[model samples]
Target: MLPPHRARRAAGLLAAGTLGLSTVFLGAIGTAQAGPTGWTFSESNSPITVPSDVCSIEWTITGGAGGFGDTNLRGQNANPRIVTTVVAPGDQYTLVPGGAGADHAAGGQGGTNTVGQGGGANGDIATGGGGGGAASLVLKNGQVFLSSLAGFGGGAGGGAGGHVPDSPSAAVITDFATTPAPGVAGPGSITGQGYACEALNTPPPAPEISVVPGPGQLSVWGRSGGPLGPGPGVAPVTGYEYSLDGGPWTTVPGGATHGMATPLLWLTGLVNGREYGVSVRVTSSAGPSAASAVKKTTPFERPGKPTGVSAKVGPSELTISWSPTAAPGTYPLTGYQVWAFHGDEVDGFQVYLCEVSASVHTCTAEVPAGVDYAVYVEGVDDKGNVGDYGWVNSAVVPLGDMPATVPAKDADLVGASGPITTVTAGKTVVLKGSGYMPNSTIRAIAYSTPTELGVFVTDENGEFEVTVTIPGDLPAGAHSLVVTGVDPQGDVRHLRVDVTVSASGTATVTEAALATTATATATATERLPNTGFSAAGPLVAGTAALGLGAGLIVASRRRPSA
Candidate 1:
């Protein structure tokens, strides 16, 4: 047989013994016999080709960086005559491809690799996933779908000068090998991930902030995060602020020490209730981060009860209802809401039943019958303020039904999921003042109860809005709530809630049953008034105040100044 090197010679390629060119596979294309190491090639590699087109080059795929940004394998340094375009194989990435560090400076290295593959030409970032070289691949017929694992390595990035092992089995093409088909060979590797040189001191994997793990510190899993030495230009990580269950956001102290390293929990803090997300801002004492990843955490909150609820009796043309807001408030009474599981009542519920001075306990809705539905109600004060939905069970309603009720006097009722029954304060929180008459509403000062932090006054829709930053200096401990809501009719609504504030400034409200919660945290929140709650200091907005008053005081209070 002709010598393996001489068996597949093509026009314009370096013949054997010229330029130290050796025979190597170029991923999906056939092989070219050049010298020992001078990149033996016949022609440039196209991103794709027609199945009927002749196959000529060799091909190989390398692993790529794990996170978002792109990685490139520069072609400038490759055999100048050979043009290559790398098609990320499986879950590949290509950020700032080619060049040593960036397009602005340096050129990339060449070879096969995987996570952490291709390195910066200057070794600015870590090596590509497989440490394998990258090549841009062109799909034939345009119908090939790459595996999720097919990732892009930094294009010929820099600093990959060390001895990295390479695969030995590459297909070499003769003028006759691809006559019947296009030049391509694959369906090769069998795993989603692989690596070339795996002995380096890898950093502790970065922490994951997805909804699955429930945000906060200690959410470590996947990739890299810790004390491992920094990878090129990595910014030193300090602490981070995060949110939970989509509540207020605040940053705190804590992070891995390796500077310039890739940390999942990098710059941003955790937020509650919403799908988590992050952007690692690399920083050095020299300055802030230059390269950032605008990536959102994978959301994994459990499915909630079917939402967008409305009720109709068909006979009265009355449609009673409520909405399940994504707002981060406590249950039993999210704002002015009251709820009962379906089928708990034989009759539908009435919006209002009792009416007395100062107290709304007499205000109850009768449960309708025949149809399965939950019931709830929000208390509206005389000043037009609405309270969280309070629970009532004067009667029960079954599926597809309605019950009878004798007419009660002068009570106005709106059907709904209810109202914002209860919400605990963050170290600092926005006070939602709604539902009060324009000029007649009370100040946030009067409604400032701990368990019941009064927000802004109501609007024309009887809904008011206010953004009050909860101070971070309040005492940390398990506490209860007491709030008062005045309506347009001058009636006051009372509410009681409970919460816990950790020493590190993590605030969480407990459920009505007082169950310990692992979610819903607000770092900075204002204190609600207790019986002796002395009006502490005046409300100073936006300052990071870390000290609270000597004692808890009640009204005759100091108003929170805007």
Candidate 2:
């Protein structure tokens, strides 16, 4: 049970609340003091929730009409509005309607108060003008749809004595179909509805990204965005954004579009042997697409130097050993190279002994006895990178040995006579020896000088015979001949012969001259044995006769004997 004017005000407040225009009405109305009555709507209602199926929407909205008044104080018209656009569902929006203006309060009556028991007459007071209405708006999908300006309220009637005329309201509202326009200063009223939308525009798909790793960088490429169904409405891709190792994304310049080729982008400053994860996304006029899948890769480098190189020397052989080197990248060690050098000369000729597998750490090389050598090793990786040589190792081969039992022997020298210990300058001598290593080399040399007399190989019995020509210019003195034997194992043994040489040999009878004198004596002895006289008497008689005959022959030759 409320007054008619109050009930109408309540109904207007409810309509403003339904359109979300209560806040604007509160601001438009003045303070509710004794001065004048001002119009106001209720508080704003909850926002409208759009359905998910809806893609586009159309809206038609109007502002509140101005309040009514006397002939001189007519109210203004309401604001006009309209909107249409594409939108996404599940979005919330607000709608606002204009509030009506309030009428002015009535003027107060004139009164007389007692002053010294005599009443004083006072003039009638005029009332203030009404307040203006507030503007309104309709928002769809977080965007403005239509708006209206405020309208002014009517003025109060004139008092009894001071006749104050009512003020006129603002003019009628203009068409706000194109854009939201403000309402005039008049009564507040609204009339509009929302319409269903058409189909929504399709978005582009996510890009496919790939990465290729090089020496210290990575190459990235992508493919995204294509033409729509049978029309010109093709989603256009502008560029791409990339993230490294789950870091912040960085935008690049180019991207693949409909009926276009994709380009690669090279990124540098990457560390070698490090793995990286990368992702990409494409951008278009609508918005950005989802991120692509992660791509993994790693940069590579050469292997490092080997370690723990060592060499062991055996008789006529060298054994080398070392540890395998490590690679800094994904490549694995493939093999090892073993090398040998003469001495400390590394840059000289390097003898490539052998190539061994990565698992094998040792290798052997055949070398000459009693020689010095230096060894080195290197590692090779699957990526074709050769590591530096390891530390140098010195190796020395040990000497070899000959047979035993070569020291003592049956050593003797023989000349024309049997077993001569001494010899003249022009005499020829024969040397005989036994108890030497079988199939070994035997050498006869002059002990005083470096002259080699003869060289021979021992027979199966370990015996050798060699003819040596002693130099005629050899000094006439005591000299020693050295006989040496060397076995297959490179062992050595020596025998010495002491001999004496005379300065002169003119009176010495050689073996051939002695044999001739002996033959003549044997013939004379045989003739005496045939004559039957006593062997001594015949020989004595013959000797005496030979002496007498020789004396007579001499005399006859001297005296011419008959």
Candidate 3:
């Protein structure tokens, strides 16, 4: 049917008869009509997008090969019985099973049951519709292909042209009974079977790729196939894959040579020249199929720089090897490396081709063979790229014994960060030291605090450091640090550390009290203490001697005193 396009193209078109198709390769669901034919049958194709559930229009009825056996056949139908009914949208249907009534003898050729669909030949009463050839169906979209009506009419021929297609009327008729009567001579005959209700989709599998050659190994090839016959419009595709260089693409297994045979499958080793690329992907469960053209292969090529290099002296130790830099013609080498130098102490070498790819010259170690070392070698190619220029000096391998004395914090050893005992004035105490044979004549002196005790000197990793920040109060708390380690063979080592003088003294309030001067002084309490608690007791000295002995005498004069 092909019309309402919302995204439905799962295609298919392989026509013939019996209408029975189901291969879920998807592509299916309504709309199809193909019931009309006269002759010619080359097995048509090209209409494939079947996977949408697979149900566009499927057919296979073919059977027009019984005409050469003519017995004056008219409306042939010795006993043809095919009654499929269902017709609305404008009715119409017929079924005339009444044809073999006179000297009958034509029907028999629907072998293997109904293999290629063709068997209905025995009807020659004198003239009338019965040649057998008109009734192929394909209505899927809305469905409708009517044509089948052979009622009693053979006074001159004996009808036979009703294969019920849009059909209807005849209701239900499967009558095939005729053995001895009506014109006699040849009892019965009639055969033809094929169908198609709608359903055709099986096309999507054709991808390819190839490249074979493996000893060292490099092989890859494949292809996959599917739709060819089940016809409709666009059906016939096959593809496979293989790629490199840019890389990434592989698929091919027997998708479609169109017919059927084997396919292709193999992948090994790979790299031959360099630029390896390929592509192919054509698929049409019923639609897209067209994209192929892109292939390249150098698989081999490269001739130059990469040759003999050896070194394995032993005294101090050195081992190295290399070869394959001779490309006069056939190029094929993938790795080698070895590099070392002592007088100048060089450093570079290690290359093996493919996988870890790096090995240009040569390398095998064990120079501890005891000292004197110097070596070099390199090589690689197969797309693993590796070569960073290597070969430094100092390859001197006297190994063991001469490398242990550089320890005192070896940069060369020469430390002198002061006898920095206690420091925290300006806060810059960091006299670290480092020195190595830099002409090792190092020096560092930084003493700080009191009597202008502050100093700083510098040298190298033989050891010399200076970060002096302790110059203000030389006499506060704990302070005693001195470090000096030198070696020009004078060999003097003295380093002590103890510093803790967090002393910061400042406090003054001379004699302050002047808000109103007299902080508080109302000492009038003496009024009661004037003479009470101080008495020796004894009734206050007998009441002060009876008030001065009763002032007796004084009374004598005072007559009233009597």
Could you list the CA RMSD of all candidates, in the order they appear? 29.5, 50.1, 43.1
lDDT of each: 0.27, 0.43, 0.29
Tens-digit lDDT string for candidate 2 (1-562): 1211221101000111121112221111110111111211221442555555543344444433334334445334433444333334576656545444444432221211111111111111243433344445545454444444444344453211111111111111123343335334432233332334322233346666666555566666555522222112223456678888999978875443222122345667788678999888766565667788889977554445678888887644568888777643346777776655542222122344567788998998654333344565766666554444575555434422322222232244333233334444444444445444444445555534444555555554445554566655557555665556532222344555555445653112122111101111000000000000000100000000001111110000010111
**Given candidate 2, what's the lDDT at residue 278?**
86
Top candidate when judged by lDDT against the true structure: 2
Query: Where is model 2 poorest over a 10-residue stretch in terms of lDDT?
Result: 537-546
User: What is the per-residue lDDT of model 1 for residues 1-562, given as tens digits with 9 covering 90 to 100?
Assistant: 1121221112211123211112221211111122122222111322222221222233332222211112434322221111122222232222112111222123222233232333322333443322222322212233222211222223333333212222222122221111112222211121111112112122222332321122221132122233333443333333433443344444433443322222233222433333444433322333333322334543112212223434433321123344443332211211222333321122112222222232222223332221223333333323222332323222212111111211121222111122222333343333332332222222233112222234223333434334443444556766543323333332333233344667776656553422222222222222222121111111112111111122111111111131
* Global fold similarity of model 2 (TM-score): 0.23
State TM-scores per candidate.
0.20, 0.23, 0.22
> Which structure among the candidates has the greatest TM-score?
2
Candidate 2: where are CA atoms >4 Å away? Answer: 1-47, 68-71, 94-96, 105-128, 137-147, 154-562
Question: Higher-lDDT candidate among 1 and 2?
Answer: 2
Q: Give the winner by TM-score: 1 or 3.
A: 3
